[model samples]
Every structure is written in C-alpha cells, then in structure tokens.
Target: MTTMNKLNQVILSATLALAASGASAQMRIEISGVGSNQIPVAVAGFADENIAPQQISAIIKADLERSGAFKLIDAGVITSMSNIDYGTWKAKGADALVVGTVAKSAAGDYEVRYKLFDTVKQSELSQLNVSRAPQFTRLTAHNIADDVYLKLTGIRGAFSTRIAYVKEYDKRHYELLVADADGDGEQMALRSNEPIISPSWSPDGTKVAYVSFEQKKPVVYVQNLITRARTVIANEKGSNSSPVWAQTGNKLAVSLSKDGHTQIYTVNADGGNLKRVSNSAGIDSEANFAPDGSIYFMSDRSGGPQIYRMNGDGGEAKRVTFTGNYNISPRVSADGKTLAYISRRDGNYQLYVMDLASGQEQRLSDSTDDQYPSFAPNGKYIMYATQAGGRKSLAVVSVDGRVKQRLTTQAGNIKEPTWGPFMQ
Candidate 1:
C-alpha cells in the first residue's frame, strides 16, 4: 500500500541559472579531468618498516594515471634514486617523478611522505604528507592521492562520499544499497516485495528516509543505521511516496494522495499532521527542500509536467521550466545551485541539470532511460537510474559531463540513487 504512482512529475525543473564563469577554470588539478595528457612520470617507494613502500607506490601511481594527467612508468622500469639522473626521465619524455616512503608510528599509525618532481625544470613540483592507521591504509592512500592531485591540478577530490540506490532482486523485491562514491563498498538494507523508491538522506548523513512497500502500501519510513530502528513517516491509504527530509532534520516534505489528490505536504519526521504545501489539485509531488526552505517540486498544472518552486508555507509558486514537454524527478543540489532531472530528448529520456539562477540547461548522461538524479552532499557528483540492453542499473556522472562511473550489482534492476546527507 505504499504510495503508488506509475510516474509522477517529480520536480524536473530546468531552471537554476548556472553561471558561465567557472571559479577554477584556469585551475591546475581537478577532482575529475582527462587521463589523456599522459605526462610521463616515474615513482618509487621510499624505505618503510610499518608497511611496504611498494603498496603506497601502487596507490599514487594509479591515482595519477587515472587523472589522465600523467603516463605512469612501470615499477620494474623505475631507476634507483641513487642514480639521480633526471635526464633519463626527461629524455624518456617524463613530465614529472614521484618518490615516497612509509613509516609506522609507535601509536600504530602509518605515515607516508611523497614528493613530486618536475623533470624538465629539474625541481620539485609538490610535496605531500599523509598519515593513516594500519587498518585504514586505503583511506590514507585516497588522501595521499588527493594531496597529489590538488597540489598539481588544484581541484579538491571527492573520493570519500557514498551513493544510495534501490536495487531490485525480483519484480516484487527491492533493497536499498549503499556504495562508495566510485561505486565500491556496497551494502544492503531493508528488502521488500513491493516497489521501493526515492531514498533521501538526512543533512547530517546519519539516517535515511525512503518509501517502502513492506506493508503492501507505499509508506515513507525513516531508518537509522546507528540504531537499526525505523519509524513510519508517512503511510497514507493512497500513494504516500517520495519523502524528502527538511533541513531541520525534525521535518520532512513528502507527496501524499490522502486528501483525494496528490500534492506536496510537510510532516514531522515521526509522521503526524501533514502540512500540505501545494493545493493545485493537478499532480504536485516530489517535494525537495532547498537550504533556504524554498520547496522545489514537479507539477503539471500548466498542462504538462514542469518544474516549480514555492515557499515552505505554500505561497507564490513560480514556474521554472519552459523548454521541455516532459521533465520530472527534479532534485535540487546540496547547495541549491543546480537542479537535476530526467528530460525527454527526441523520444528517450536523459538526465539534465539546470542552473537555478540563470535557467540555463545542459544535457548530461548518455543513458536513454535515466531517472532520479540526486546530488552528493558536496554537490559535485550525481547518481541516477539507467537502462542499457534492456536491463536497468545505477550510474553516476559529474555535473559537467566529464567523468562518469556506473555502479550496481543488480540481479534484476536498479533505480533512484541518492546521496545521503553527510554523516556527521
């Protein structure tokens, strides 16, 4: 009995004016950029007792090469630092060289120090200092890698976030899955027979609010990982789906048909008296709360589904999209600077992002049937559902249309990947 809607206009506004001027357009390093420049580079492990220098070397080598900024030299081909010949690398067209060492502290922490050298200038490019516990070596490697990329290119790395998505094992069963930002470390929670949809994280990242059909009705439930306890937030007789948590953590904005029609409504996190936000009577669902409390939602009152925004109290709703015939599943970015949605192009649907300030729209993702694009807490990456070869799965892409990585272990299909609020 979970709120049932085959397809409702879920906040697919192509508004949000994105500024053309990039703050770091002339920057050096990047979180995601090309791995094609192929700057020939050589790196060797420094002496270490706590762990193998070779292990840390592998991490740095992979990260640099992944950036497409450098051509990583094979470990076997690396020359000794005693040789001290920059010409060998320079002659081999090496742009830079990296050398590092690892040490274990008495307290059991591993410390790694690395230096990036400019082969052409015969000078040091950057120095990175990193420390991590023995059990957290991978995290340390990620940080070290970020240090190197930032020192060289100047963009912050996003290797520490998580993506939440719905994975269907069968037509009647689905589970919410959490994976690494790169789609690693996947874990499942809350399995059910009816359709599960719209997993939204709290701003603090501790708990999650999603719609599940365990009771044979679409009901919004807020689940806490730390406690392994869940309380029903919305379980109306009709469709009660798409639960979005408000900024205060004590409230939620959700779509309900309890009043005989679907519209945006607000309720306490524990599920009580619903404060209806939209009363158009058309189809106002998928309410996403921006930072300032302005609710962004999808409504077809204008005849076709379009994006609209209004205050939390439900006054002065403004239309945001005038370009597409069909736009739905609008997700406002963490910073409320961008809106991501599934827009129909030609005959297929693709993910699109619009700057709320400028109303400029940019098409992203190549998946023909993509849906439910949500932003990470940092507003850098987006995860959504995509169909390929008639099979459904989850995928993520950068907002700029540069980097993309697909994540799923779906036995059947996957949908609605959302970045939970940052875990405090």
Candidate 2:
C-alpha cells in the first residue's frame, strides 16, 4: 500500500536487486514461494538494455510468483534456448516462454519490447507492449508484465494502477502519499506533524479526501491530485474524519462531532449543507456505500462494533452482523455480494470477508497484524496492509482467498490502502 503506485514505474529494474535507488520510489512485494504447479517457462534477457544497471528478470519473476502463477526457471539450471531448444522447455515442464529487448530511443527515451510464447503450442501467444513516460521509463517492465498477465489470465492487470496510503514515519507525525501499486515513485499529498488518518478516493480518481492536523487540530480536506491544491471539506469543533464517497459522486458520507456524538453526516465535496445521517449517541465513524444504495457502517451502540445497514436516506439502522465480537471498516464490494472488514479472531486482528447473504465468515490472513482492506475496482481482489516478522508490508488477496499477494516493499509502514476507480 505504501509503495503500491510509485513502484509501477520500476518493477523490472535491476536497481531493485541492489535495494537502492527506490527510497522514495516504488517496488513490488518480494515474496518467496513457488506456485502450486510450476509451469515450464523461460524468460530470455533483454538484449539492448538501458542504464538501469540491474537486469529486469528478477522483478518480473517476483511479480509472476506473487500472483501464485508461473514458475520461473533458473538460467544456470538450463541449457541455451537454441542448442537444446525444440522440446527442451516443454520437457522441462515449461508451458510458456518470454523474451524481451530493450533500447534507448534516438530521442533519449527508454523502450522495452516483450513477447509471450506458448511453449505447449510452440507459437507466440501474445505481445506485451510498453512505452516509457517522463522520468518513469523504469516502470516499463511492470506495464509489460501486466499486459502479459491480462492477456494470459483474462483479468485486467493492476500494473498501472496507483495506491493511496498513510505513512507515519514518526509515531505522532503522518503523511498521506500516493505511489505505484508496487510502492515506487512515492510522493506526499499532505504532511502533518500531527496525526493524520483515513484517506478516501474520489470517484473520478483525480483527488483524495483525508483527515489532517495541519492547523493544530484534526480536519478533513479534499486535495487535488494533480495540482496538490486543497480546500477544507469538513472541519468541526469535535472529531471530524473517516470520509466515504457516495455513489452520486459528489456527496461524502462523513462522521462529524460538531453536534455531540460522532454520527454520520452528508456534505458536499466542498464542505457545505451538512445533513445528519445517524443521530445515535454511540460512535458511527467508519461508513461506506453499497452499490444498491444502502449505507453499511459500524456502531458500538450494540455494546460492540457490530455491522449496521441503513438506507441512503436517513432512517433507523438495522444491525447486520451478529457472529462477530469486533468488526470495523465496512468495505462494500463493487458487486455488493461480499463485505470486507477487519475483525478479531483467535485474539489477533485479521482481514475478514463475509458472505452478505449467508453470513459466512472467512479469515483471509494469518500474520502478525492486518488492517485497512480496500477492494479492487473489479471486486476480484482486496488490498490490505500487514505487519509480520517485525516488518510492515502490503498484501493483495483474491476474493475467495485462494491467492494472497504481498504488494509493497520494505520502504515504510503502509496504512489505509484505498483502491482507485476503474481506469478503463
């Protein structure tokens, strides 16, 4: 989540091997596991590489492995592509082949060309094309890999998407940053020596709304992504934070304390016409919208943070979750079939996704700690942050919990990973 977006630029650069040149930049979750079945495949090195100094194969291998797909073959463990080539890969259990070439353009730009070959059929399967952008050519490998992923897997690749997260380098200070989904090219959106928390993305994916303490107290501000321009969206005398964008694309369901208790309120994106949604005395802070025009939230009025559902129009909320001791962060999936949240299981905090209809609960992780799960635009995956082995990291898991992927590097502690709107 921390480097989720910035690393999209240099996912396949050799610099990652050195673990340098990406302090503020992004890289992907480097996982060490082979797929259930290693497909027979070989990736030839790029011939005309650029100044990246490190080769791109390692990064590519990491992405493939993290997906729990494709088995990478070691070069030393194999012979040349031509010498024993005809059926060598297929015999070695390689079902595919990948080859690439890199070069510096006459205009001083970087370019990479890659091809995916189906070894079983002995023919090229697809072509993954990538062109570099300003100061971001290094991310070419991720784009290429993503293209290959979509073509082969029939799912939209997230290689080009961005991730929004909060970084608390100091215990009391925090900064809201956006980076590549793989944790490269991290840049600050807002920084405060005071505590900052909870970032929500606009429907247009062009701006972010987050709670900041830049003025010595907590306040919510809608920040422009391109211009870095920000204006106060909601700032009350009491606790005012935890914003969730509405389906209408203009209204934000936020919790305000200017009244007395932190109840749900609806206000314009520019901060005006505050209408109360919840009038309860207990906490109603974490709330998100569902696709079917209902609001799902957490409330301790039931003695614990039980899940509650209410209509888009303000009314009495109906409690939905009954089997949980603790539940917060109600994330409505794009399809609205499953609800993802953080809950306590076996005395540890873990990510949980529940079947909205059957109320069946499933824990998606077993780690030191996990928090803040945001669903991908397609609803196929959920991205969350985790801490394990005394290290902070970001991870992505498939909806059914079959595939779990760590998507961040060892750069900084990543918190609050909010997925962006569909980019297609």
Candidate 3:
C-alpha cells in the first residue's frame, strides 16, 4: 500500500485557516549552472510622476536573473528612456533593452506602456500596454516580466504562477503555504496539528487537492483558493491520498486503500462518481494525468514499483518502466512525450526521465534523496525536493539536467512542492 512515512500525525482535528498573514518570507535562490549563454538585457525604470522608478525595475531584474538566462545591466545608468542612447547600451554588452512608462489614468487606475528593443540590431522588438488597479503593483511587475520572457525565449513564461508546499513548524504543527513562483508573498491556506501531504493544483489554478491527516486518518480535501472553503472529496474506511487533477479540472485521480490494497480511482471534484482506474492486487498510487486523457501512475503489481499507463476509462493497462526495481512518483510532461519519476539505483533514490516513445531513460538528479518531481508549465524545468546541508529544500533543474537552482527556507523543512498551472 502507498504510505506517508514522512508525515508525523499525532493530532486529531485540522483547523482551516483563512487569509493568514501575507508576510514576505523570502526564499533564497542559488543558481548553479548557466546551461547556455546568458542574454544581456537592460530594463530602464518606467518614467512615472508618482511611482518609484527603482521599485519596478528591481522586481523585473530579480525575475529574469533567477531564471539563469539573462544578465541584468545596472539600472542606475539609464533610469528613463526619454533620451535614447542605443549606442551606450550596445557598447556595454547589452543585447536587449526594455523601457516603459507608468501613469495614473483619469479613472484612478494605473496604466503602463513598455517597449522592447534589440540592442545589437538597433531596432524595436515589441511594445505592450497594460492597466491594473492600484493594489496590483507587484502583479503588474510580474506580468511585465512574463511578457519580456516570452518575447525572448519563445516559450510562455511561468512567472505569474504560484507554488504550493507543506512546511512543518514543529513535530505537532504543520501548515500548507501557497506563494508566488519566486517564493514571496506567502499565504497560509491550512493549519493543523496533524500532517498534510501531496498538494496538487487544479487546472484553473483556483483550487488545490491534498491529503490531510486530521481525524487521525488520511482524507483528501479540495480547497478553493478564493473562499478558503474545503470539501472532502475522498474519505473512506482507510487512507485516501495522492490526489491528482485531470486536464478538465472537474475530476481527480487518487489512490485509495479501502479495498484492502492501494488502488487507483477517479472521482468527481465533489465526492461522487467514484470509479476505479487500476485493479491491481499489489500497490498502485501517485497518479498523474497526461494531456491526451491517459493516466500514468506508480504500481508494484510487477514485483516492484514502476510506472504504468491506462486509458481515461481505466482500460488497457501496460507497464512503462522495466529497468528499475523501485520507481514511483511518475509525472508526465504537458506534451506527453517525457516521463519524470523517482528511481532507486545503487541503493540511492534519484530522479530520472524517460522518452515515452523510445523507452530510453536518462538520469537527471544525482541526489540520493530527491522526491516529488514536478514539471514547469513550459516543460523546460523540473522542480523537486532534495536534501542540502542536511536540510530538506526545493530545487529545480532544466529538462536536460544542465541548468540548476535551489530554493531553501531558513527555518524548517520544506516538502511536497508542486508548481501551479499558468494563470488564465
């Protein structure tokens, strides 16, 4: 059966905490490798009469720098683009330049206009205009960063997405936190003395499904991000855990132990329409859905834990992994061409990816304790939890295992990190 060995559950009731403090608990990010040549970019402060110029530029620079794809030039050199000097920026080794202006409209809203320039070619690349309410300053900055990233990399930026994870304050206290992709502006969604695990985001990025050991038994709950209201989607005689959302966002694929052994099942977002997806006698859990409406999950029916695939209606079961004795936590890419999972090799648990068509595999992580590997929406990066300096922290790596970065908190251990879907 699937187990929650990392969770220490000794308490009973789970308290629903709504709108807990939004204090900034910054996550320190350390970049490891520059997989490719970093693009040199300069973001000039927006020309505005009210807003501080340095504030907006700092956020944009931080976002691009963290990706390990762009090298930011000094904002002090060019505060505003009222006077264009392309030759100066080009001489400073900058390939791209960004300039923008922010103003308050007659209706008391903020309007921003930005332009992107190709410094080397000495031509304009793109222009964008955005408007937002007064309270959405940070969000506006992130959207600007997203636009710049997409324009340069040709891939949709995930800067505006959120991340959900479990943080243990002590042995008896644990909380579920949701924060920005850069690990700022954290808000606590749930608090309990019991343990919480396996947080999965819905397709719309409005709800999260997770397993909470509140009643001294594991139960799955889906909580809405806006109202903070939760509904028990799975609660049976035994454990109900490892909830994964379908592409449609109306159904969930989960693992249940009510039938004596762990088996994969699908249920509506509400607690109805229960259907079994896998009928294996051994253990089967950690289900993930592909874009093609197929279910990929972990199973031990073939003597050890390995990945398996089935249709949407729970038919045509087939083994997907054969080289590893222990493989679990299968996550398929959004394109449905690659599969990332945890495998045991040389008595050490590590992360590996396999081509779904060719059945060829390549190891991605060297850590012996990496877990909960998740793919970014762009399919360019994979985020997972690993131990660093004896502390459990979250780390991300490119698909080819070239670029790497780690995000760690100063206090307690961070676990079960799941990247949210792109904002609609």
**Local accuracy by lDDT, each model:** 0.69, 0.71, 0.81
Instruction: Compare candidates 1 and 3 on TM-score and give the better one.
Output: 3
- Arranged by lDDT with the best first, the candidates are 3, 2, 1
For lDDT, the strongest prediction is 3
Model 3, range 1-424, lDDT digits (tens) per residue?
Answer: 0111111111000111233443336688888776586789988877772463336666778788877778888745344555667798899888889887788888776777777888888887777676655645555666678878888888877776678898887668788888777776566788889999999999877789999999899999999876668999999888899999999998999899999999989999998999998887899899999999999999889898989999978986899999969999999998899999999999988989999999999998878899999998878788999986778888888888877888898877888999988865
Question: Which whole-number lDDT from 0 to 100 does residue 230 have in model 2?
Answer: 82
Cα-lDDT of candidate 1 = 0.69
TM-score ranking of the models: 3, 2, 1
Tell me the lDDT of candidate 2: 0.71
At residue 110, candidate 1 shows an lDDT of 73
lDDT of 2 at 283: 87
lDDT of 2 by residue, 1-424 (tens): 1122433333223222223322354546555444454454566666655354445555565556666656676543222223335376687667777676666667766555666777777776776444454355435565556665665677766655667888766476676777655566576666667877789888767778888877777788888775557878888888888888886678888888887778998888888888988868798878899998789998999888888999876798998777768888889898899999888767788888999989888888777478888988767678887888666667888777767777655555667788877443
lDDT of 1 at 235: 83
Q: How many angstroms is residue 185 displaced in model 1 relative to the true structure, after the best TM-score fit?
A: 1.4
Instruction: Estimate the Cα RMSD of every predicted model relative to the unseen true structure.
Output: 10.9, 5.5, 7.1
